[model samples]
Target: MTGLHERHLAVSPDWLALYYRHPLELTHGEGRHVWDADGNRYLDFFGGILTTMTAHALPEVTKAVSEQAGRIIHSSTLYLNRPMVELAERVAALSGIPDARVFFTTSGTEANDTALLLATAHRGSNQILAMRNSYHGRSFSAVSITGNRSWSTTSLSPLQTLYVHGGVRTRGPYAELSDERFIKACVADLEDLLGHTRGVAALIAEPVQGVGGFTAPPDGLYAAFREVLDRHGILWISDEVQTGWGRTGDHFWGWQAHASSGPPDILTFAKGIGNGMSIGGVVARADVMNCLDANSISTFGGSPVTMAAGLANLSYLLEHDLQGNARRVGGLLIERLRAVGAGSPAVREVRGRGLMIGIELVRPGTDEADPDRAAAVLEAARAGGLLIGKGGGHNTSVLRIAPPLSLTVAEAEEGAEILGQALHTAT
Candidate 1:
């Protein structure tokens, strides 16, 4: 290991994971490319797990952040920060929830934690419904509700969580069912689950399960579940940490795929939005948001600097129509990846929507997940000057591809070529 890597290992928590054998330190980034401490340039396909939404060091966001920093870095939540209020206003209007209220946090974990708080308080139930292979965040409550065993660290939590099925279409009990049948079966299963519990406060899910390998149920599955949840007065929470802000292309919010059921009662968003600045929040209708009786505030949330960054980032995204860009470019990228994966026996499935794509690796002609090959592919991709990510609910055997929304056609083609070569080499 390098000197910096050695120091990091000595000081950091053992559970803190780093990518690649050498563990590169990213020195700088612009658009879709980043340079390591060693000055090696590589195409950044993962975009720091999709946190860098628009682009690295976007001029608009950078200027806004710099200008805000000059004025004031932070003012505690006690004051009426103009930038904070502006950001909150924009987010509330776009939240899709009626009469929405927005509460800011520093990360997705805290966002979900707040969502859980609101949910349990409003419904007077600590029971939560989570999808199998779904991943939320990394806090006590968030981890408890996560259905992926690979990510969940403990069973101890304040809320009681029940795991539901139908997140992964190709590897579950209802895999063979037709789309219509699949929806019906999942709804029935949800009904059965609810009946067994005293009462569920909310059903939290990721429309595209991020750390669960971008696995997702067919569209309308959640809508069907919404139908059942409504009868019981249970709230639905969409964890849009990964699928929000048009990252999924076809819809603005991931739940829009299930629009038949209407917007979720509560929605949690983090990752992206402020570009690289830490920004997260929960949006809910006035009733659910106001349910909490006690006073609460996020000390570092919605500070002037971060709020300015968010406003600039959001304006750039909407003005440029990056959502449409994601739709057009992402459509081409998925097709290219599918064609590349077709000839590889190790590839069990190629799935996902928009810029978020996943290639599931398996033992050739076998059902077993091949995490070793996935690791090999990751290393090879890095060596080839391309950076990707790995994740899976079954195992860490899915290659995650999520580049910046501003990726050009040439960059997408180049990434595909490198990935195709890396996949074959890993075999």
Candidate 2:
């Protein structure tokens, strides 16, 4: 009866309750596992909502951070850090964007905000288009482009009207309208909006929707959108906050997942880039970046500490072939999940690519919402020593599992087995 829980006093409230967090207070993590204050270990399939990609306590990252902290930490934007420049160049080279200009930020939201502002500044346009159910970030400009209603408040400034595209329905998640039909609908919407709208700046999209249920746009969706943007003299911005850093597998840059579409005018990346080191960036063609005035700047965006961490994280990713690991483990995990869910009455669908997986739960006798069951599954998984998160438009049912790229095949199988048991208990 005497434990940490007993030592702590319960209060009505002091901290902001933004999310429904588990009762566990994580005290330490190593690799893909975390330990709560009570010393109970849990497999971190969630990876801090897809942030800790290189896993926790990576030796190289730790060493870099420690060294940088001892040498130099923060310096004004007026001065440049060697590590910052090196990391930027490495990112450009790895991303296959030759001579790409990089602007750093402390978080995904800030990176996205910078991208949006740069798009408008370069094109002298205000309107921006984003796909429905898309999540950009929480900053004002980024939130304005996000298509989710739950993330927005009533008092928020009016969103500039722009075209929304994709995510059509037919039968199931993958059985939706043909890829061709989906592309046509998207093109038509863009064309119509561009013809009537005053100044459309950018067409933004996720290579693979992250918070939007790990959904991938239909084939040709990106190419068609690129064509439409070119026709209207608009910029294409690929928001790879969650999908970048090899999470999608097969490529270093998430946008490469849709190479047929050609390169985006502006690309934003965060989350996995620094392996939870609070670094994000906007990489753009030199021409587009040059449009920004000399007045544009950030203070702590590319601090030495963060740059060192990023460099170490990037090195670890390449040296270990983490991208390849993601593909191999993700493929096996997907196959296993599909096999497990094939005949389950509670499973409505299992859809996703690479490590970004989503398991949708269905109501027993109806297509209606089933948030209760989803919550039950989440609780059961936590109790069973596994961690996962929820996503999707309705938030009714979606178990998002995006573990570290370093996660092994055996670990994936173990997580899946635990998930199966949790689902069985919940259902």
Models 1 onward score TM values of 0.99, 0.93
After TM-score superposition, the amount by which residue 56's alpha carbon in candidate 1 deviates from its true location, in angstroms, is 0.6
Steric clash pairs (candidate 2) = none
Task: Flag regions of model 1 displaced more than 4 Å.
Answer: none
lDDT of 2 by residue, 1-427 (tens): 3354434435434432322334567888999999987799999998887999989888899899999999988995789689989998887766666568998999999998888888988988777888777888877777788776656433354347464767423233334557776667667876887778877888888877777667776656777778877877889898989988888777767777568867788999988878879999999989898897778668989989999999998889989999899989999998888887775788877877778898877787676547788888888988888999887766547788899999999999998898888888988
lDDT of each: 0.93, 0.80
CA lDDT for candidate 2? 0.80
lDDT score of model 1?
Answer: 0.93
Q: Over the stretch 1-427, how does candidate 1's per-residue lDDT look in tens digits?
A: 8999999999999999999888999999999999999899999999999989999989999999999999999887998899999999999888889999999999999999999999999999999999889888899999999899999999898888998888888888999999999989888898888779887899999999999898889999999999899999999999999999999888888999999999999999998987888999999999999998999877899989999999999999889988888899999999999999998999999998989999999999899999999999999999999999999987899999999998899999999999999999999
Count clashing residue pairs per candidate: 0, 0
| Distance from true location, Cα of 236 in model 1, Å | 0.4
Backbone clashes in model 2: 0
